[model samples]
Target: MKKTILLLIIISTIISCKTVKPSAENNVLVLKGTVEKMGMSTFQYGTHLLKTESKTYALKTAIVKLDDYVGKEVSITGSKVEGYPVENGPDLIDVKKIVIK
Candidate 1:
């Protein structure tokens, strides 16, 4: 009886445990484009920019350090870091990786 109770406790503990998920705070998206322009300002993500084949997006959620990848053709995976629909500007994105392809 004691052994069964102990086994049950262990199983319950394992089943109840939760695993952490990666931060989905930023809405991740992918874009391919040239570094048409870039800038930094006192914003949420410290201000970053990219001009894609279709449109331009801004990185403005959390300060992203991507100065090393300016003026290059690349693919970026990040979240739509910031922006409002009415006042169209760049959507702040937290870049996951910059691939020169």
Candidate 2:
């Protein structure tokens, strides 16, 4: 009984750890980065930007006020808006969720 309880506890602990990893697949974009206000641009679409290690992303959202999380590292889950990245711009993501780290 004690061994079984220990095993169950170990499994539960492992499963409880949920990490938000950055990924882009099948028009779904999951990423972690620092949020910043969008600088001057010719195309006015997104309100903010997310900068990661390798790439930067233009971001927009109606779910949450992105202005609250500016200059902080965050994890984001969003969908790629159709017809973006025009003329060598970053991919535009319609953020559904934002979690500050």
Candidate 3:
């Protein structure tokens, strides 16, 4: 039937138009921002924050303490721990290297 064929075509078109989210695994991300600590209400410890132009991301670093970078501009290279479309709060990332700017 023509109606059945049209329905199938519409379904295929809709499925093809859907967007897919990028995987964070093994994908290095470079972000520039100021390092700062999240407030007490965040319910997290040993995690800092990178305040960028558009979004603020939670920074998890084991190499260097974030206290030294606080209030200072820095460029960080790391892989994302959490993807965008964060519902509750900022996205999370694991820092690999940091350079003061």
lDDT of each: 0.63, 0.88, 0.79
Which tens-of-lDDT digit does each residue in 1-101 have in candidate 1? 99999999998787666334445553568788765445544443325577777787764433434666678888887775434422444566677777787
Distance (Å) between predicted and true CA of 83, model 2? 0.7
**Which 10-residue window of candidate 1 scores lowest in summed lDDT?**
81-90
TM-score of each: 0.55, 0.70, 0.64
Best to worst by lDDT, what's the order? 2, 3, 1
Any runs in candidate 2 off by more than 4 Å, and if so which? 1-26
lDDT of 2 at 88: 76
lDDT score of model 3? 0.79
- Candidate number with the higher lDDT (2 or 3): 2
**Which residue segments of model 1 deviate by more than 4 Å?**
1-26, 36-46, 60-64, 82-86
Query: Tens digits of per-residue lDDT for model 2 on 1-95?
Result: 99999999998876665333434455676899999999898767799999999999999988989999999999999999889988678889999
Q: Please, what are the lDDT tens digits per residue for candidate 3 over residues 1-101?
A: 99999999999887776534455544888899999977764435337889999988888888877788988999999887645425566777788889999
Better of 1 and 2 by TM-score: 2
